[model samples]
Target: MNGLDEAVAASGSDVISASAGSLRERFEAAFMPNYGVPPLVPVRGEGCHVWDADGRRYLDLIAGIAVSSLGHGHPALVEAVSRQVATLAHTSNLFVNEPEVLLAERLLGLLKAPGRVFLANSGTEANECALKLAIKHGTATGRTYFVAAENGFHGRTLGALSLTGKPSIRDQFGPFPLDVRFVPYGDADALRQAVTEDCAAVFLEPTQGEAGVVPPPAGYFAAAREICDATGALLVLDEIQSAIGRTGHWFAHQHDGITPDVLTLAKGLGGGMPIGACVGFGESGTIFAKGDHGSTFGGNPVSSAAALAVLDTIERDGLLENVRTVGARLAAAVDAVDHPLLARVRGRGLWLAAVLTTDAAAAVQAEAQRAGFLVNAVQPDAVRIAPPLVITAEQADSFVAALPGILTEASA
Candidate 1:
């Protein structure tokens, strides 16, 4: 047998038969230490729950950090992925594909504007494309600086990280190539002061997802739009975590009744299938000419198909209406839970954070796992809950019923 064949033969059986402990041990030995070993080995999933290797079921509240919009094993998502992969999975930018074009059209339609889209494989990649677009626009306009919101997360790639406002993660990568200025989030005055005539773009999230689900003040985006318009800066909204009906809107910026020059989207766009889009409205859309930038798998049929499925499902199932009513109910219920450890809930629609009275988010997360619930410790003092868009009122009620007890146990 060939070398590759022999290697696969040697390890395939072991991998198939390994239990959770054994799998984790192998993972520690074989994989890079970047993420460390994950706590649970999820073997299967259905609806809003996942079964670990030990067959323990847990109600998934975070939905893969807000990626799985339709939840686990969604038939629409599954069928779209299966059909696309089987038909035409990978077509390089050398040729155009139907799903990619349709997705771009659909995204622009949702935005209620004319635009061009550049598809990528993740949020960072989408932001990277935006960065290049901004740079190109800068080069043409003789702009030198960029402005972004403090505590806002754009992405992890070097250029995108430069735009990100979190110091803890951005500082280590140190001295980024771009000249990006940071202003306090939701502070339109500071944003106006920072985004001068020479600024190329202004990057901001409608709601800061990584900063424990913090939404901007009322009319924040309108002020930003005005600032960018007067200063000739491109307003780039990174809706990586808030788009695709997460906040009861196609794009979170829609709530503000303003549109961004450039909008970056991912996460829920693909329903866990890994797709991102960098859409530019009007002139910004056509900034990247013939050979400015490209990704080998950027607009591949499979990912595009998956994205279309997510969009279609969201529309067909009336998930936006569901998000508005159910999300409000869920937030009210969680807020009403009388507990000393709980402070308040932040964010809009299904994206929420249970602020704590103390730094017990980690303990609460752990306790929640033991109680058959999965939540995210987005911060030391915040527990993030961004469940699937398809999560029913009944499923959310289950978590609400168990939360007080979970908090009590965590306090101990």
Candidate 2:
């Protein structure tokens, strides 16, 4: 049997037993249907690999939807979390903690811009905070409307969902906050027309992650910055999936040589622990007055320490350079394959997607899982590949080498 066949055969029994049900039963009984039913119940993970309940190993490329920056079980992350947990876990927003202050400082330093940060527990919360800040900042001038880009995803909270451009998800969740307009992404002219003096903010992603890693044209952000400046609107860039070294930079917008008035970050910020931040620059940073907004569990000691460790480890181990080098290597290798089924590669650094010629992304994802790899079919024709930063070039090449067979099986 070929490698793919052997892989499937070897895991067949485990798959059958898992489907017959123990974990799935327990999961279905307790969990909400929001995530649907997960196919694999992972027992443990280390480095770039995770093992299912049946003890079958799969190369984890999705990295918890781009949350696991240091991969699974890095010593630094574990040590930091454990130490902070033992010392103090939650202090709430009523009190300040060292880790929280330090993390905020470090983030601002990385941005190299004068800013203040509001911490939160998730990306949605961060975006919500940014939205609130934008509105509050605009209240002085009677600005009300918020402009976002089509196909851009900010988050799923009511406010953030209002800013999201995907109608399929947002349509069902509305009576969302009104006065949100969307222009086609990467169209500077559309944005210029959309952002009037009445606009409160214009939110965008450096690259649309949930829209299957669609990167905007070069200078798109720069032009948006100019438009927002001319219109006196805050430029809020949602870096939830594109920040924290995902694109070989502290923030993806930094690559465009532009600074946004507001920036939101979450995924990969705490390595795996949930944490998010809404950072506002210059006068925008000071818009949130007392009692403006707060989070009960935001910037908890444990999550803050974990985030600090993630930052320290990334700097100490030079993972940023690794991401740039290995990411380029992987992208080049995949493009060089020139498979008939493959359309093109999109995204930068470790965050990437392989566009397929056919609407077989879901099948390709399933085939990849069967072949002992984990990936995400973000769209009908796009397979998102965002492995942990710890993933080596060799590991990436392994996935690239398997693409042709995986696509062939998916087509069948």
How many pairs of residues in model 1 come into backbone collision? 0
| Runs in model 1 lying further than 4 Å from the true structure | 1-17
**Model 1 worst lDDT window (10 residues):** 1-10
Candidate 2 lDDT over 339-399, as tens digits, reads 7889989899999999999898999999999999999999899999999998998899889
TM-score of 1: 0.96
RMSD each, Å: 4.4, 5.1
**Candidate 1 local lDDT, 1-412, one digit each (tens):** 6543365467766544468898999899999998889887876678899887677899999999999999988989989999999999898999999999999999989999988999999999999999999999999999999998888998888989999999999999989888989999998889888988999999999999999999999989999999999989999999999999999998899999998999999999998888889999999999988999999999989999999999999999999999998899999999999999999998899999999999999999999999999999999999999999999999999999999999999999
lDDT of each: 0.92, 0.91
Clash pairs, model 1 backbone: none
Clashing residue pairs in candidate 2, if any?
Answer: none
TM-scores of all predicted structures? 0.96, 0.94
